[model samples]
Target: MFNVPAITWTLTAVLLLSGSYHFLQATKSHQLTDRVNNILHALMNILMAAMLWNLVPSTMLAQIAVLAGAALWFVIQAVARPEFKMLCAGSQGRLKCVYHSLSMAGAAVMVAMMGLATTGHAPAGALPMAHAHHSMTPAAPSTAAATLGHSPGLAIVLTLLFGAAAVVFILLVLRFGAAKTSHRHGTASGRSARTAHGLEAIGAAVMALMFATMLA
Candidate 1:
């Protein structure tokens, strides 16, 4: 009844439309990098939606629908932008490489969890309760049902990491937006400035939502 699939579909639609707009701008300017980045961002959003949908207690039909939608989006990205395949092909920075590697690993884990959940093989008690119902249950536990049995230490570590990443994302968005604005007002060329501005705003909104959800 939580209907996570609907939420995911809505988010995916937003990302797809945004990505399409960015892609059009990139084509007009011949900016391959911007196009690639936009496509990747779209793919990431779809994958995230799938991951969230998998977390909800849904029927196998619903889970399959979510997975299929995400997979279709991913395939479109791969076909449209083959260059993204080299994102981590030859990277050599120890910290940066490790960070990206871990991120990908985490995404994989989330996808696998979704699959298991769909098949009813996932660990029990992993779905969050409706906030509206909380007030009616006086003895309800503070910890989310979805996170019950999870290691507190791991949760803390992940919180710190996600928090730091959120900050860095905010800074990058600000810097990118400023650079784009400066270029747009006859100060410089600032190719793909508009796309950067859009991404910055999206990143900020996403971070805010994540922070709020974490607190809740």
Candidate 2:
């Protein structure tokens, strides 16, 4: 969760939009794998946005489980043999699956971290994933120490990883956009691809920022 309400609200809106777009794409997709992929993206985004506001606290563990399972699914797709035509076949497709696997795993880690952080503070009779007050103050020395103890070196590592992912996606967005521009009469498919990359870039950047805040 962010210390700043503005940042939190802005990310919430962006996540909602991204989630909705993915759900829409899922509905339109003809391929079963593509539809499943889009639905997973939609669920992940919506759940992440809900996490920011500590909504549906009882389901946090379930959310983490779902994300971890989704990550495994993507990994399976990535490593499947070429003979498995229904899975990711070519090198590029496999690489994309690998990236998605990493991202889903990262998201699972984030939710788990947040759940642990708040567990001790929740009232009796509530589950470990119960909600707590969202503190806007900078993390005190004691709180930081506790986080460091609970998370060790994980936060900074995720921050760097997501930051790198953001840069890569941003580059993809630029490259795709440039290709469309140069083609003059670029296909609708090209524009849609560029837009998808742009959304990916935004999501990566937001995740990176969120991890950085955990470090702070």
In terms of TM-score, which candidate is strongest? 2
Q: Estimate each model's TM-score.
A: 0.42, 0.85
Instruction: Compose the digit string of candidate 1's lDDT tens values, residues 1-216.
Output: 124667556655665565566456556644554455445445445555545444444443344444444444434433443356533233332333344334333334344433543343333333344344657863344343234323344434444565565576557556766766776653334434544544545533442343233332
lDDT of 2 by residue, 1-216 (tens): 887899999999999999999999999999999999999999989988987997876776678789999999999999998888988989988988998898899888777677657663322333222323235433343364356336737888988988998899899888887887788767888888788888888888888887777775
- lDDT measured at residue 34 in model 2 versus the true structure, 0 to 100: 90
Per-model C-alpha lDDT, please?
0.45, 0.81
What is the model-wide C-alpha lDDT for candidate 2? 0.81
- The collision pairs in model 2 are none
Off by over 4 Å in 1: 1-10, 18-41, 55-102, 114-156, 179-216
After superposing candidate 2, which stretches have Cα over 4 Å from the reference?
A: 121-149
**Candidate 2 at 80: error in angstroms?**
0.9
Q: How displaced is residue 50 in candidate 1, in Å?
A: 2.8
RMSD (Å) of each candidate, 1 decimal: 10.9, 6.5
lDDT of 1: 0.45
